[model samples]
Target: MSINDIIAEKRKNVEEIETKIAQLNRKLSFSTLSEEKKKIMEEITKLEKQKRESEYELQKLQNERLNELAEQLRKRREQEKQEERLSTVLPPVEEFTLRVCFKCTEKTNCEAFLTKNRQKMLPCILSELLNH
Candidate 1:
């Protein structure tokens, strides 16, 4: 059951105990009064104990749910931080460098093109990757 439902049930039990105690107090007389009072007190104690147990269980369940949500939030934040770090600190493709032929496409030397146009092509390649 939900925490609120458990708490409401606990409150109901307490109210019942209080009603019983009040009734017992009203019915108290000289004959057998002590025995009846003791019995009613015992019943109240048991009900109170049950109420405490229910409250404890409710708290435990709430804490478990809170912890699970907290863990999920923490993991999501950590993942976002890792992504941010990667985006800011690392290039899109580490194994490849930007090399484009400015003169002609046929029989172009990629290494010669990269060495000559590295400064100009770097920003264009990074922007394309970012947009993609």
Candidate 2:
């Protein structure tokens, strides 16, 4: 049938074999010599092999999911950088040189100059702290 159906069938078989092995181990603890006892020991070994294979398959599926998540994070970062460039918004930079002129007694003439538009440089609220 489908891929999922195949995996489901394999998993079910593994569980059934494991249960059979557990039952056989319980029977093998006593001194016995029948042909059935030898057959149960062989079956237990086979079920142990199947259990290892199923565990490996589960680990492979988990690894694939981790790789998919890493790829999605890379794609998202690229998209955000492209959008920022198209909008023409400059990245923030330090304005360590912007200070008020020394023509006033108080610090009510502070300004924050932005490279985006010189005309948009408004008075800074830092003036309030200075007056207080």
Candidate 3:
């Protein structure tokens, strides 16, 4: 089962244990015999321990879920930052075409013009062309 399902089940178990303990306490109050009261008290003790264990497990699961969500949020933020950096480094499509592609005589079949790093080199190349 999923963590959420497990957590819900544990919570339910804790609640049921609490209810049982309450019922046993009510029964203990009405019991006239010493043996019957001792037996009821023992059962209540066991149920209370079980309730404590269930509550601890529920708290652990909730913390784990929170950590998972925090990790996902961190990764998404990093990806968005990387995309923003790329967008700032590269000129807009229209400006790149006008500044570099239109001015270059070898528009087609030019290795430097068609290479992946052309965007990085475009500014330097354009500056050299302007100087000449």
Candidate 4:
């Protein structure tokens, strides 16, 4: 079962145990026999322990869910940061095409020319050529 399902089940168990304990306490108050009162008290104590264990499991599952969400958020933020860096480094394809391909003598074979002469400083070279 999923963690959420398990957590819900645990919460239900705790609620049921609490209800049973409340009923047993009511019984204990009404009963006059010492043995019956003692038995009811014992059952209440056992149910309370079960309730505590169920609550602990529910808390653990919630913490795990929170951790998983935090990890996903961190990865998404890292990917966005990487994309931002790349955006700053590389001109958009449309901008490159407008500034270089539209004006090049090799317009008919610009794709081939660009592939063969690809360089880190291609924008700078294009700017110098355009200036002259």
Q: Find the candidate with the highest lDDT and give its number.
A: 3
If scored against the real structure, what TM-score would every candidate get?
A: 0.47, 0.47, 0.69, 0.74
What C-alpha lDDT do the candidate models reach, one value each? 0.61, 0.59, 0.80, 0.78
| Higher-scoring candidate on TM-score, 2 or 4 | 4
RMSD of each: 9.7, 11.1, 4.7, 4.5
lDDT of 3 by residue, 8-85 (tens): 888888889989999999999999999999999899999888888889999999999899899999999999999899
Question: Candidate 2: what lDDT?
Answer: 0.59
Give candidate 2 regions above 4 Å deviation. Answer: 1-17, 85-132
User: What is the TM-score of candidate 2?
Assistant: 0.47
- Candidate 1 lDDT, 107-129, residue by residue in tens: 24555354655555465456645
Off by over 4 Å in 3: 91-132
Per-residue lDDT over 86-118 for candidate 2, one digit per residue giving the tens place of the 0 to 100 score: 555532223312442232233334333323233
Q: What is the Cα-based TM-score of model 1?
A: 0.47
Can you rank all candidates by lDDT, best first? 3, 4, 1, 2
Per the 3 Å backbone cut-off, how many clashing residue pairs does candidate 1 have?
Answer: 0
Greater lDDT among 2 and 3 belongs to 3
Instruction: Please report, as a residue range, the 10-residue window in candidate 4 with the lowest summed lDDT.
Output: 112-121
Task: Tell me how far the alpha carbon of residue 90 in candidate 4 is from the true structure, in angstroms, after superposition.
Answer: 1.2
